[model samples]
Target: MAIGITAVAVPLANADVTTKANPEGIDVSSYQGSINWSSVKSAGISFAWIKATEGTTYHDSRFNANYTNAYNAGVIRGAYHFARPGNSSGSAQATYFASHGGGWSKDGKTLPGAVDLEAGCAGLSQSSMRNWILAFYNTYKSKTGRDVVIYTTRSWWSSCTGGWTGMGAKSPMWVAHWGVSSPSIPAGFPTWTAWQFSSTGRVSGISGNVDRDHFNGSAARLLALANNT
Candidate 1:
């Protein structure tokens, strides 16, 4: 070890996440713990989706805290619900989500809530799972007047839903693919609004690895979607 030499910084994981895209963002639950959102914003994170609720009753304990802090830190804030079709009716879940902190606004900054559909639908047949997803969307849209984003990997969606394309022309996708250069989304949603490219991403302000994401189009489009314009 030389005293005069400067050591180069090495990331703990997924150092190549920046190479995946330019205006990227993150998604977090209580998993990341307390985040230094100002530092996160200063590090070039453009937006964030925080876990808000799940099923018909359980809600993320840290959702409101993260939501307010992200807004105060100048990060575009959004909420997401971890689906549990087996726990209760999908409409009930949607209603529960909105009752919590999952409402969308026309502020041109807040993103509509996204429904995470994947392993939760595991073991259920494609037909039953599709019905549940439809039930969720129907009630969620009716309540929020905003289209919800669907998050799933191509394989998970295909296997669970038999590649169902029923939500045509409405739902945008937020596909997740860890450690990959690009995400492969389900056929149901032709284009994606966001791509969660890596979960092992190292970003400033967050102590551990965080999920990294890229918006499909420009930031303007994102704001437009938020505003529902």
Candidate 2:
């Protein structure tokens, strides 16, 4: 049986308590102003994970347009993927990301670019899929020289990522395991820098809804993440 939760869109009165550990966030498709960004800013929302590129043929239409709004509101923002499945080895998807990632610059603040791998795609071998991911990462890095972050569940990390110990330095991790507390991150997988804990979260200042995220360290640490990378 599935558990039920009665959720309301609460303002960040106790944001310090709420945005703790792997804090609250919403994974959004569009903005409608349903969430209160002022309250979110006042409430201390740590970060936002926005949808950027998807398949080679499709990208998030609203990402670049909306990211600036979030940034101006003092929200640290990141981007995610929807995985092209069989086409993971294609360069088009990478190019799409490279073109539409708002052009990250030196000393210009931008969240790490991330690849969201899931079971949405079919008919691709593990090697083929990994090749697709590498293609995107390699090509994008060649243009930007920035490392790419990987967003996956624990199971995907184990089966698809091979052993985390062997991952290249260009890869960081964003593990999704929504629950009350942060879950056990895999050892060979790598150190997860962010955790998605609750999808049921509601923050002020966003329209319709948004995904709330927490940097896996103190606010000081988060500053380091933003300034360094």
Clashing pairs in 1: none
Worst 10 residues of 2 by lDDT: 1-10
Predicted model with the maximum lDDT? 1
How well is each residue in 1-229 modelled by candidate 2, as lDDT tens digits?
A: 0001122332233122232544444455544433444566676775666777777666676776657666666666666666775754546666777677624553223566677776643666557666777787777667666666777777775566553444434576667777657655643444567776666665655544444555565543443344442
Per-candidate TM equals: 0.88, 0.76
lDDT of 2: 0.58
Error of 2 at 109 (Å): 3.4
lDDT of 2 at 171: 70
Q: How far is candidate 1 from the true structure (C-alpha RMSD, Å)?
A: 10.8
**Model 1 TM-score, all chains together:** 0.88
Clash totals, every prediction: 0, 20
lDDT for each residue of candidate 1 in 1-229, tens digit (9 for 90 to 100): 0111122332323112233233689999998999998899888888889999987778888888899888877677789999987777778988999879889876545788988886556467889988988888888899999777788888878888888988756788888887767777687676667889888999999999999998875555555555566
> Candidate 1 at residue 154, lDDT?
88
